[model samples]
Target: MRYSKFLLPTSKEAPSDADSTSMKYMYRAGMIRKVSAGLFYYLPYFNMILRKVNFRIRRGMEKLNSNEMKFPILVSQEILESSNRWNAFNKEMFKLKDRNDNGYAISPTNEEYATLVSNLFVKSYNDLPFSIYQIQQKHRDEIRPRNGVVRAREFTMKDAYSFHADEKDLHDYYKLMGEEYTKIFADLGIKTFPVLADSGAMGGNMCHEYMAISPEGEAEIGFCDACGYAANLEKVECKDIYSIDGTYKNKYDKIETPDAKTIAELMNMLQMEAKQFVKSMVYNADGNLVMVLVRGDRNVNEVKLANFLKATNLELATEKEIKSIGSVMGFVGPIGDLQNVRIIGDFEIKGMKNFVVGANEKNMHLRDVDACDIKCEWADMRFADENDVCPKCGAPLHVSQGNELGHIFALGKRYTEVMDSVFVGNDGKNHVPFMGCYGIGLERTVASIIDQHHDEKGLVLPMSVAPFKVDIIIVDTKKENQVKTAEELYNALEDAGVPVLLDDRSERAGVKFNDFELIGVPIRVTCGRSIENGKLEIVRRDNGETVEVEIANAKDFIINMIKNY
Candidate 1:
């Protein structure tokens, strides 16, 4: 491809809205244009990179014997309702009605459709352990789109679903899919690690997210180096490390603590430590009011709370909801006679003998409240942090931010059973096929590769995914020798099956150099005054390694480098 002919719109300044390195560089490199929030107009360069990544993914799927097919972008409401996800995904789904008043959604995922497809074809157990995949667009109405394509509302995804006869077979295939996902990311030159994750909304028995560590990431990861135990922060197991050793005292007294609504205020007023006070929090768990208690310094892990209560939606109760349950917004307590509300306490607070709690009234609190005085069920609901130790090896846990690249779930019968998708077993009995779901976000993965490989200059795109392997820049396009040498080398490299980009534009040498660097071609062969010495300079974009090669050998040199790349 010649730069003069192609739409390589390189720019000097990044977009003002670009927040991360990947977003900024991708915009300046002319790879993508922002159409709106969470939406983009992918340019030819971005499309080429996407194709390379998709090819790697397709190769992995082929290795797994997964058939590739296409499904409609719009999924009917009836099918979603059959799987009971119509209401569950309502917040994120882009819903619309057809002319006939029939509602549908721009499918966020195709679990229902995949199960229905399996039901249509799999008549017996012989078709039990097969997988099918599609590289198609997926849509979700993101509440806040950030970091460009990392959290886009509409983007491409490779979603694969596997069906098996039983739970064991499903688990086996799920493991294989996880391995394949690891290889696919590896092939794309993106480093990722799998961690246990919560199966939110998907309703799976188990799941793991492949995470790439980045500060701009949204997902929090808690990992241990000693035991090699890693999990999504929302799913980390907190051990019961709180136990009081002193003698118990039944001292529960109400006190007038004026204007101490928060734990910090209460601590300042009473001159007490954060661990000495218990916080009473009210949450709306799937429309049911529940009171949760934890130490003042601890934060509730909503994922664990939702999993414990088997609730689809869990959020903090509003002031009106709290008042409806006869609990004050800032003075909720486990000791109150809250009607129709379940009281749950964190396991760490079970051994507490004397602690401060809310008085269940405005500007008031209870001092020296004992554990026996509070009526609640105890469970582990506190978020794990740096102070926490690993549940497996007792080593100090490390916390970091990570972006989710791929996710594989052991879905079991969540969709098949609900959708009435079944197959005939060897015994001639109808059995619900167990399912496993695997997904890779094509754009997010591309951004992650940028995040992991870039430097101060620009993207250090890997050879496998770079838009062009070599960028042949003619420093002096007006000079006959420079232009002639560059054109010859570009044609030869192209003939040798190397993706080459020739900068034949009438731009300054510095401008040409900057553009190619920003574009991040693997190899850059400069045709300049050096051609007068029967030599051209070859520059590597990755490490900026420059070497002078004879014009006679430039084509073979670049081809060998790409062959080994």
Candidate 2:
């Protein structure tokens, strides 16, 4: 490719709207242009990255015997209603009406469509374990899509689905897809770890997300340092080390606490540590008053709380709701024989003894309270933090934040059963097929690759994904010898089956050098005064290593250097 003719619009200044390091560098490298909030124009260089990523994903799927196919982005609402997901996914789903006034949706995913496809083609158990995939655009109506391509409204996805006649087959395929996802990430040169994921209302390792660790990411993960147990923040569990089985010095007793409504105030007044107090929080779980208790030092992770209680909505209880429960706001406790309203306790609560709790009144507390004396169900309902003991091996966990690049899930019979799509079994009866889903966000994956592989200058793309393998720079385009040598080298590299970019523009040497680095071609060759000496200067982009090679051996050396790319 000739740099002068190509649409490589390199810029000196980064865009103000970029929300991450990758986003800024991507703009400066001319891989993308911002069209609107949450929308972008992926330039030719960006398309090159997408093509490579898509090729790798397709290769992975084919190895697992999955057939590639395409689905319409705009889906009829009838399909969603058939799958019983219309109402459930109404919010965050983009709805529309066509000319005939029929409701439709810009598909966020292809779950229902895949089921519909099976409804037509899969007629017998002989077609069991069917796997199909597609690389296309997906949409979401984001209230606020931040983090550049990391949270875009319309982006590319490589989504795959599998149908099995039995649970074992589905489970097996799920594992296979997980392995394939790991391989895909490896091939892409991105580091990833799979963590436990929520597979809807059902739970288990049947669902997992391949997360790319990055400091600029948005998701949090907790991992065991000893047993390799890792999980997302919403589902991670720490050992119950704070629960007290021994008795306390004093039994439950009323104590005066003036203006000590908060935990910090009470801790200061009683000269006690945060672990000595039970932090009781009031919440409205699906419009019903409920109390969630955790240690004062811990926080209630609402995602876990709602999932545990099977609540559709979980938010802090209004003052009116708290008052109606015969409890003071900020003073509600699991004790005091409080009735009607349900109380839920964290796993840590079981180990707490002789702890302080609210007395169901203002400016008062119940001291020396044992959780056993309180009526509540205990479960893991708090965020696992740093230094928390690992539930698997009792080692301190290492918790960090990251970005998810891929996810594979076992859908069980959720869609197949709901849509009443079934196949004739060997038993001569119609039975629903178990389903599994796998997805990779192409835009996010590209951005994460940039995040994982860039430096202060610009993108340091992996050799396999770099737009071109070699860059030929005419240090002085005004010099005829430099131009002829650069063109000859470019033609020679092309003849050797290597992609090379020739900087044929009449620009300054410094400008050409900066642009080549920003674009990040893996190898660069300068045909300057070196050509007069029967030599060529080769530069490795990753390490800036320079070597002088005889002009006759330049093509073979460059080919060998980028052969593994």
- The models' CA-based lDDT, in order, is 0.89, 0.85
TM-score of each: 0.96, 0.90
Task: Give the lDDT of residue 78 in candidate 1.
Answer: 92
Q: Name the runs in model 1 displaced over 4 angstroms.
A: 243-250, 271-273, 351-354
Candidate 2 residue-wise lDDT, 1-565, digit = tens: 9998889899999878888888888899998898887888999999998899999999999998888999998988898777666655536789999999999998888998888887888999999889899999988878788888889888999999899999999998888899888888887889999998665533223789999999988899989868999888777775555564654344678999988888888889999999999988998886788888999888998878877787765778888888888889878787765756888899888877788999999878999898667777877878988867777878888888899999888888878887888899999998989998899999888888898887777778898788798889999988998888888888988887888899999898889889888988889899889899999999988988899999999999998888754
lDDT score of model 1? 0.89
Model 1 per-residue lDDT tens digits across residues 1-565: 9999998788889978998888998999999999999999999999999999999999999999899999999999898889888889748999999999999999999998899899898888998797899999999999999999999999999999999999999998888889888888888898899999998999888999999999888899999999888999999999877654554455678899888899999889999999999998899988899998999999888889988999988889999998888878888888766787898899888777678998778888888887777767888988999988998899999999999999999999999888888788999898989999999999999999998988777888998898789999888878998888888888888898888899999988999898888888888889999889999899888877889998998888888878776
Residue pairs with colliding backbones in model 2 are 243-351, 244-351, 244-352
The 10-residue segment with the lowest total lDDT in model 1? 242-251
Q: Considering every candidate listed, which one attains the maximal lDDT?
A: 1
